[model samples]
Target chain A: MDILVCIKQVPDTKDIRLDPETNTLAREGVESIMNPFDRHALEEAVSLKEEHGGTVTALSMGPPQAETVLREALACGADNGVLISDRAFAGADTWATSYTLARAVETLGGFDLILCGKQAIDGDTAQVGPGLACRLDLPYVTCVQKTREVTADSIQVERMMDDGYDILRLPLPALLTVVKDINEPRVPSLKGKMKAKKAKIEALTAADIGAEKQFIGLAGSPTQVVNVFSPPPRGNRTMFSGTIEEQVSQLVEQLQPYL
Target chain B: MDYFLTEEQQMIVETARGITEEKIIPQRAELDEKNEFPTSILQDMAKADLFSIIVPEEFGGLGGGCLEIVLALEELARGCVGVATSFAASTLGIFPVLIAGSEELKERYLPDIAAGTKWAAFGLTESNAGSDASGIQTTAVLDGDEWVLNGTKQWITNGGEAKIYSIVALTDPSKGARGASIFVVEDGDPGFSYGKKENKMGIRSSATRELIMKDCRIPKNRLVGRRGTGFITVMKTLDVSRPGIAALGVGLGQAALDEAVPYAKQRVQFSRPIISFQAVLHILADMAIQIEAARAIVYAAARHIDSNPKNMSKASSMCKVFATDMAMKVTVDAVQVLGGYGYMKEYPVEKMMRDAKILQIYEGTNQIQRNVIGQELNKEYA
Candidate 1:
């Protein structure tokens, strides 16, 4: 089985502060990290390749700086990296992003499995994975918490729910949007890092992937960001001070009307 | 003159920084208080293949050398020198094996040590032989196919915890230093016992205990290199490893400066931030300059050891002495800059101060290092 993992580099949320005066995100000095969910996605793909002999290729669509994440993936045991970078791909919405990725997948002759994070931390939209699967005409499972089994023709997985989880079997060549519960990501090995340093990252442009100009980048996106602002603080907020019991009773008294 | 790091070297620094910042720094205080060996952190480092930085590829390593180890250690010590010491001391133990172990011994020991499945420790320091390795009283005598060892090695970093020990023992006492031989002793060997753990002033997170070898028996195959070649092997290993200690010093000095510069900026005194004061500014300047100079020399020495191993002894001692002394002064100045807060345990500088002290003492004290440099100078001038 050949596995493809789609990863993203997002601003570390821990360092992102809300500018109260401007009602906007203050991203100064924020370090970019591999999307936490995407790390689990990559870990699952690598583990699968390890258990069953196969090749794992990491795929990402971003600016030149995004190549860092791809190199990181290689260091974490990916055999190859495909960086889909182009100036024309800037300001792409989820729809265009998925279309571009799907085209890249087709350009690479597809794979037996495709894995992605359930959602990116920066944009909690959770639309690209399913959209890519739809464009490729393959079945996909979202919020996959566990992989029950994987074989040549099919894969069994547990899709997480609010209360419990649902066991589902999907045919091979399917897509998966994995949650963080899948597995612990391994640290990159030194040998893997040496290989990454020497390895030539295969770069592709929109034209190289045979993507139509009308269906890629900002020009192809349907949705636009009208405004970006932080939510205003709510009026009714209370601090529970005192011992645990007193705080609980005080909170109960305050919530009596709503209850 | 080219100070730029290779892409691979940059990656090593980045990777080590990530692990140290994310994993090691958070647990440092608690580990220090408990004086516990960083076993789990080592496991994490193993996962990152840090143990393989110095081992050869044929021995199941990344095939890196002194430069790579220096890169990783500097980043690691920046986070916590105690943790870095634990990591570096294992490499020190493996050095003798890598330098002189037979092919079969390398195959038996190097792979596991490189893979980080087992930790290794060097056993040269003793109660009576701190700087004078010629006085190492540990003795190993051949009895048929086996060698019996009886001695106590003191102040061994990773002594009780490590799985393998590279011990320097006198095989023929009459020949003095020339009679010394090194052996690889496994943890489970008969008559191998551990003494009381030493409570230390700095790098307390690393395990320091006495390795008591009472009638310890090992196969003759465990002998590293030819008989009576142990002292030279030890010297060469230290010559190669000195830069690692220098890198640790540079990292600690940098860590101290890291704390001071920010605190100086934010800390208000005399109705303004302390950084506005000329005194504070000059202190910061001196700290930065010293650390950079130390770092430059250390990097040069490490690269020289990797590329030109034959004549690195003087350069190695220069780096070790210069960097460690710089660390001691820089850390003390950092504490001074922070004033009361620096003295308090709430801040990291005090701990860094404590940690910086050991850098000057271990791996050949600054006094011994000066001796090496002076001796080299005499030989060159003569």
Candidate 2:
């Protein structure tokens, strides 16, 4: 089982600040961490490789500094790290990201499974995994909560739903965008850290991956984030002051139209 | 303020810091309150390869030196000295083996310690043998193929929980100080048991119990280094370990200062934030200055020990005195800065202050350290 885990290096959301004037995220000086959700994806991939047996490759598409997350992944158990980084991939929306990642995946072929987080913390956009699956024409599952069964040819998983969950099985060479409930990630061990320090990461460029000029970078994306800002604080209120039972009846009567 | 650590040293710091943030910090208060040992956290550290930092690579470790160990100690102590002390005491136990144990002994014990499957502890302090270490009454007599040990070791860190212990006892009482010999004893060995656990002022999460070895039997091969060289090994081990204790003080002082500055800025007293007052400002400034100075000496002392490894008692003692004393003063001021809130258990500064006192008292009391330094000065002048 050769697994490919797609990860992203995003500003640690804990310290993230919004630039009031620009209506955009102010990333300068904030620490960069592997997207929290992607860690679950990597954990799932590594565990699968551990239980069965094969190589686990950590794949990421971002700036050269994004190599940090790949090294972290390698430290956590990934056998190899492939970073697809190019200046041309700047300001890419979800559509362009999926395309660029698809091209990179095509370049690094023989993966029995590809894993990704349901969404990036910074963007909160959950479209890339499904879009890449569409591009590769592979069967895919999203919000994978548990992996019940696995074999060389296929895998059975529980897909989390709002109220319950759905059991689904997909054939080999599939894609999975996992939820955080998949598995707990392990800390990097000394042996693993030593290995990661000495290991060489393979880097792929835009041209090397054969990405077309019109369908890659910011120009390729159809969707645009026109503005990003926190919603205005609401200031409307209706007070119901009485005994517990009286307040409950009053609250219900005041909310009749909405109900 | 940068100590200019190498890449490998920085990695040790970062790895330990990760464990501190992810594991120790969250559980520190509860563990301290309950006085519970950080057994699970130690396991987490083992998984992180923290336990392997100072052991020889041949024995499944990184073979790191004093600087590396101190770096990790500072970070871990920042989260909780109780946990760091438990970790440091194990290294103290390991030192006897590393410094004097034969190839056979090292092969037998260091691997399990490095793996973190079995923790180690050092036992030397008895109720009667504290400041005057040579006064211990524990006896280990040879009986054909075995050695039988008797007497109690008081305030032994990691006492009951640690699987391995390296302890010193009298082998030939007539020889006085030279009569003591160090031996390795397993926890499950017959006739060896732990007495009552101590309720301490700080670092409550680390276990401290009496090691009671009543006619405890061990094979002759368990003797570390040579016969009757136990006192020498004890000195060398303390010489090697003092810098780590100093690092714990620096880390504790820094944690206290870290709490003080932000608190000063936010805590309102009078018309504005208390930091607006000169008295509060001065306290914060002093804490930062003292912590940085303490850190500098600890780094220098550790670096000196790692580079030369000889004639280090004076340098090691200097750091132990300076850093630990600095920690005591700084933690007190941090509490004063926090005022009534700092004295309360709700804030960590109170806990930090409690933890700071032990650093001054252990390894070598600040008074004992001054004596060592004074004696060294007389020798240098002579």
Candidate 3:
């Protein structure tokens, strides 16, 4: 089986700060890490490759610095890496980003499986995985909690639901968006790190992939962010301070307004 | 000029964190309560190639740098400070040998340690010599073809369980600290025994005992470095080990803060989450600042040791002093944030506080660290 895992390089959320003036993410001097959810997806892909005997390729679409995530993926056991980066790809919304990624995947040739995280923490718009699948016209599964079985013809997975879970089988050449419930990613071994340091990532631009310029970035994006603001402060809460019985009476009195 | 950790260092942290969370944390309280030596955990750590961390790959080890070891210790401490303490001490005890031992000694000893088949202990302090190691009365007299060691080493981490010991004894009683010598004594040597285990306030899971040596005989070949170099070796070893201890402190502190942040967010005090209160938020913010500062110093010390081993004593001392004290304060504040629930043993912050206290006391007291910094500063002025 041939696997392609899409990962994103994100700011370490613990230190992430927003620019109040422009409603943009502050990236200066901020440390970048592979998105935590994407780590699970990469782990799943590596595990599948380990069990079934195949090559795993990590692909990402971002700035030139996005190669960091590919190197990280390689260190974590991916056999090959590709970086889709270009200034023309800036300011991409989910639709345009997925469209460009779908074309890039086509340029990279065929694969048995394509894996991605359920959502990126920075955006949280979980549309890319399914959108890419729609563009590729392939069977796609989202919120995959576990991979039950995989073969050349089809794959079975446990998909997470609101109440419980559902197991589904999709044909080969499927796309999957995984949750944190997937397998824990393995740390790179010393040998794996040395290999990653030496591995060359195949870099592609929008034009290199023969992507239509109109459907590439901000100009091609259908949705635009008009405004972003923090939510308003909540109303003050009443405190009931006293002994248990007195507090109960106070709580009941406060609840009377809602009732 | 990369300011962040190398890829290998990052991998080491990840691997160490995984092993620690999965294997060590669950057994921490049990091991402490039972006064059990974590032989199984040690075995698992060995399986994860932890023992080979500091040993050079040419010598059949992973060749991890000081930063890597610090990272591993940080993760391990997050699981259990005591277990991390013991594991780190073993590495500490063996470093002098790896650094200054003869080729024959290195070949004979390092392989077993690297393989995790044997554990090592450093014997420097005695009943009378806690911070003032130069005051130790342990004596090693050169006799014919062997050295006769007679003394008691107190508060020795991994004391009773270690198979190998690097002991510092007075070789020339007339020369004070200059007279000290380091010797390698294998376990089960004649007249070598261990006292009862120590009952401690924290890090109780790690075995700490008094090593008693009476006429303990070892071949002259076991003499490490020169006759009067033990004091220097011990001090140098501490320079490396202190960062590890600081890293442990930082990890424990972060664990406390990590727990407190979420707890404050979810815990309701008066119809709203405690985190919504300015006082609580301020405390959390302060704790975060302290932890980050401690982390910076700790990593800086590790980097100093790796980049320039000759001038790291001051950096290491500073890291140890600041990080440990920060841990004590942060853990206590974590307990405060939890209110009455924090005092209960059911909450991890209490244990974390208990564990944090030792960092201020061990690997040389914060006062001693201050002295080191002062002396280094004065030397620069002079």
Candidate 4:
């Protein structure tokens, strides 16, 4: 089986800065780290590859610097790193990003499984994973907390919900957007780091992936961020401090409006 | 500060730093309070391949040298000197094996040590053999295919926890220093036993115990290298590890400074932040200056030992003396900077100060290192 893990490089949230003038992220000075959520996805992919014999390829779509995350993935046991980077792929929203990734996946050939984080920390818009799954027309599961089993033809996973979890068995060649509860990521080994340093990353451009000129980049995106700001603090708020049972009854009384 | 480390070197630092932050730092206070062993933290380090940094690549390691060990130790000591001491001492034990063990012995043990499955320890400093290692009373006698060892090894780091020990024993007491040999003693050997764990003033999380060998018997092949070269191997091991101890000094000093700066900035005394006061500010300045200087020399000494193995005594002793002394000063001053709060257990500087003292005392005391350096100078000038 060939497992593909999609990762995104985002600013280290601890040192985030927002450009006041443009209300956009201050990317120039921010340290870039692999998205925390994506680390779980990558870890899961590597773990799967380790348990069952397979090749794990780390796939990323961004600027050339994004190759660092790919390298980091390799150091954490990924067998290959494929970076789909091109200047033309800039300013892409989730829709355009997913389209470009799908095209890149198609160009890279077939994979038995594709894993992705539920959302990127910066964007927080989770459309890409499901959108990519829709584009590839594969059975997909979101917020997978655990993998019960993985066989040649099928995979059983526990999908997390607000109240409980659901067990779902999907056929092979499926897509999964995993949650942090899935696994803990490992620090890279010395041999893995050495291998990462020496390994050649296969870089693909938009043209290389056969992405259409109209359906890619910022121009192709239908949605745009009009403004970004913290909403003003609401004035009317009640603080509830008591034991759980007392707090719940108080909350119920306060919420006893239309009901 | 910018040592222009290669990418892989930076990765080692980053990984060690990650382990320090995520693993050691959080548990350091608890470990110190209880004088508990840091087995879980050590295992976390093992998982991160921290143990493999110094072991040769042929034995499932990264084939790094003194510099790599220094880099990792600096980061680790910054988090918890106790944890770092346990880690560095294990390497001290491994050095004898690497330097003197036969190929068959290396093959038998190096892989496991490299993989962090089995821990190693060096036993050179006995109660009587503090400065003059020749004073140790341990003796090993050849009996058929086995060598029987007797006497106790004092202050043995990783004593009971470690599986392998490279201990010095006199094979021919008449020849004095030249009469001794090094041998590998397994933990479960017939007469090998661990004594009471010592309650130390600092680095309390690290285990310090005694190895009591009462007619301990081991196969003759367990002998490390040729007979009568045990002290020679011991010197080489210290030559490699003194720089590591120096790096630990730099790390501990950096940690003290890390604790002090934030306190100085926020500590409002005399109607203003204490940092605004010249007296308080200058201490910070001196701390930074000395730490950087020590760090520069430690890095240089480590690289020197890596590239120049035979004649590292001068460089090694210089660093071990300077860095460790610098740590003692900085950590004490860090406590001074914190003033009343610094002396309190709520702050880490008091602990840092305590940890700093051992860096100068152990791994060859500063005075002894100065003596070694002076002796080297005499040899050069003669």
Candidate 5:
């Protein structure tokens, strides 16, 4: 199987701070890590390559520093890494980002399968996978919890659901957005580090990937961020400071409306 | 001085730090309190190929050197020194074989070690021989086609658990240091037994026990180097390994800093965080400076050993003495930064302080390191 994993670098949510005035995240001093879900996607892709004999390529679209995630993927067993970076690619929404990624995929030639994380943690919109699939005109599955089987022409997977899951089989040249349940990512080995240090990462810009300027960046077809804010605190909790029986009766009476 | 790590080194540091945080730190306090060897964490480390980092690739290892060892240990120590030592002592045990063993011997032993399927331990410290290695009483005698070893080795790391042991003993008592010879002893050999495990003041999670070898026999082919070169082999191994101890010290010191800095910022006193006070700020600043200095020296020393294995005694001693003493001071001050809470066992700084004390005492006490440095200085200046 020839697989491509689309990854992103996002600010670690644990250290995230809000810029209340601008209604945006304060990115300063925040460490960036590979999106948690993307890690599972890459892990699944690498395991597939190991099981069958083929190559796994990790591709990402971000600033130059985003090469760190690509290198990290290489260290985790990706056979190749490509970074799509350019100033023109800045201020991209999900539609534009997926459009540019589709162009990069074309430049690298199409793969039998494309894998992605369910969503990036920093931006929890979960749109890029489906958007990219739509742009590529390929069948796609989201919330893939397990890969049942893979062959030259088709692949089978279990799509997760609130109650359980649905098994789906898609033809080759399909896309998948994986969840954390897919697999546990392996730690990068020392030998892998040596390989990553020496490997030359392929860098592509908009022109390199043959992407049109209008469809590639902020000007691309389109959604815009109007405002971002933390939800107001909900003052819906009540505390009963009384003896056990009194507290229980008071709690039951307070919850009587919902009951 | 600012140091820029190579890409490979940075990846190594990141990988080790991840494992340390995920696997080692969470279990450290419970392991210490129970005084149990951290077998699961060590196995996790092995699975990560940490044991293979310094072994030759031909022997199924990563072909890394002293710098790689230092990088890994510094990160591991940040989580827990006992765990780091438990892992590092294996490297110490395997060095004699890598340094002087015949190809046949290396082929026999290193593959299992590099594979992390087995563990190795170094046996040199005896009851009569602490700093004075020449006073070791373990004796090895050639009988027919085998060498018989008989003596008790005290304070051995990984004593009963390790599958392989690199031990030094006297072959000719009259020649003192010249009489020493190194031998590879297997754990399951008849007459090889363990004494009671020591209850240590710190690094308690590591297993420290006595290695008792009474009438233990091995093929003469297991002898390392030659009959009289054991002392030389032992000294060179220590020289190569001292930087690793320094790296552990750096790790502990950095952990202390990691703890104190965060607590200082959030801990309120007198209507403000204590970090706002100049006294506390100076303490934090001093801690950072000291740790950085120690780290720089330890990294430099490790690189020095990697590049120039010869003439590293003085540099090794310098780094070991400086870094370990610095760790002791830094951890103590970290406790002071938190004041009364720091003294409490519930917080981590107290455990860090306990861990820091052993760095100065083991791997050749800081006093012995200074003596080695002074002796080298006399030779160089004269």
Candidate 6:
């Protein structure tokens, strides 16, 4: 089985700053880390590969610098890594991003499984994995909390819901969007690190993957950010001091006229 | 310039750091307060093959170089100095055997120690021979096929818990340092027992006890290196071990600085962040400079040992003296930066300060290191 984990490099949320002038993210010098959710997805993929005896390949679509995330994934025991990077892919909404990824997957030939985080922290748009599956015409599962079983033919996963979880068994060549509750990521071993350092990340462009020219970059994106701004300062709030009972009585008296 | 660590070294550091952060740091304070041996910490470290960092691969060891061991020690010490001390002492204890032991001895002992099933310790310092190692009075008498030993070793790290001990005993009464011979003393030897555990000011989680040997008997084959060469062997081992201690200091200091930077940025004084003030920034800048310099020197010394093992006594001692003292000062400043909060036990800098003090004292005191440096310089001139 060949397991493919799709990950993203996002600005660390803790380190993020906003540019008030342009109402855009200030990315300069902001440290970028592997998406926290994607780490769990990568861990799941690696664990499956370790237990089932297969190759784990990490795939990422971003700017050229995104290769660092792939290297990090490789360091965490991925057997191989691929970078799908191109300027034409910039400003892509979830729809275009998924289409671009599906094309890249097609170019990679056959894969037994595909895994991704439920969402990217920067965008918080949780549509790429399912949209990619739809485009590729494969079975898809979202918010997987645990993997009950995995075989060459099929996989059993526990999908998380608001109130409970559902265990679903899907055939191979399936796609999954995982939550952070799956498994702890393994630290890179000495051998794994050396391999990662030397491993050549095969870079693929939209043209390389045979992406339709119209379905790339801003031209392909349907939604646009018209404006982004911080919320305005709140009005002064009244204070209710003293004992809880006295405060409640005073508040009721004060509000009697409005009632 | 090979700026990157070797693949093996990087992996060891990564694995050791992960294990330390995940398993060791969370329990550090509790273990210290209880004076526990951190059995689970050792078990986890062993599971990660940390014990094999310096062991030859042929003997089931990691075959890692000194720099690799120092790197791993730095990460491990960042979590808990006591656990790091225990782990480092085990590596130190096994070095004499790994370097000079016969095939039979290495085969019999290295596997278990490397595998983490058995812990090893080096016993050299006596109550009277702290810096002056030649003053040791422990006697080893040849009795046909066995050697009978009698000695009391003080402040032995990992003392009571070690399964195997590399002991130095005087084989000839008149030859002073030249007469000292190294021997492997196994636990449960009829006359070998441990004395009281020392109540330490810091690194209390590490087991430090007196090693008592009253007419202990060991096979003649257990003699490490050749007779009358134990002093040199011990010195060589210290040359390797001191860098490890320096690395520990680096780790503690790094942790302190790491914690302090964020804290200074967040902690407000005079209606503004302390870090915004020039005075605080200068302190942080100085600390960063010292830490980087000390780490560079330590790594250079470790690499010198790995690349050229002939003679590195001066370099090793220099690293030990500089790195350890730098760590002590850096940790103290880290505490000062935190102010009242830093003085509390809840803050890590207090513990780091305490831990850093021992590094300066142990692995040869800064004063003793200077003495070694002076003597080595004289030898060059003479």
Best by TM-score: 2
Model 1 misplaced regions, further than 4 Å: A11-33, A85-90, A106-112, A133-174, A179-184, A203-215, A230-259, B307-311, B377-382
lDDT of 2 at B9: 85
Candidate 4: where is the Cα deviation over 4 Å? A232-259, B4-8, B377-382
Candidate 6 is graded, for docking, as: acceptable
User: Candidate 5 residues B64-142, lDDT tens each?
Assistant: 8899999999999999999999989999999999999999999999988987888999999999999998999999999
- Candidate 4 lDDT by residue in tens digits, B1-382: 6998988899899889988887888899999999998998888788789899888888888889999999999999999899999999889998988988889999999898888888988888788998888998999999999999999999988889899999999999999999999999998999999998999999999999999999999999999999999989988989999999999999999999999999999999789999999999999999999999999999998888888766999999999999999999999999999999999998999999999999998888899999999999999999
For all the predictions, what are the DockQ values? 0.53, 0.50, 0.10, 0.40, 0.34, 0.23
Clashing pairs in 1: none
Model 3 regions lying over 4 Å from their true place:
A1-259, B1-3
Model 4 - which docking category? Answer: acceptable
Residue-by-residue lDDT tens digits, candidate 6, B28-84: 888878888998778767756778778898998778878989999999988888889
Query: lDDT per residue, candidate 5, A54-82, as tens digits?
Result: 89999999999999999889988999999
Write the residue-wise lDDT of candidate 3 on B261-346 in tens digits: 99999999789999999999999999999988988999888988989656888999999999999999999999999989999876
- Per residue, candidate 2 scores C-alpha lDDT tens digits across B183-222 of 9999999999999999999999999999999999999999
Q: How well is candidate 1 docked (DockQ)?
A: 0.53
- The DockQ of predicted model 5 stands at 0.34
Superior candidate under lDDT, 2 versus 4: 2
What's the candidate order when arranged by decreasing TM-score? 2, 4, 1, 5, 6, 3
Selected candidate, larger TM-score, 4 vs 5: 4
On a 0 to 100 scale, what is the lDDT of residue B369 in model 2? 94
The CA lDDT at A217 in model 6 is: 79
Give the distance in Å from residue B122's predicted Cα in candidate 5 to where it truly belongs. 1.0
Q: How high is the lDDT of residue B7 in model 2?
A: 81
TM-score for all models, in order of appearance: 0.87, 0.91, 0.64, 0.91, 0.82, 0.78
In candidate 5, which residue pairs clash? none
Ranking by lDDT: 1, 2, 5, 4, 6, 3
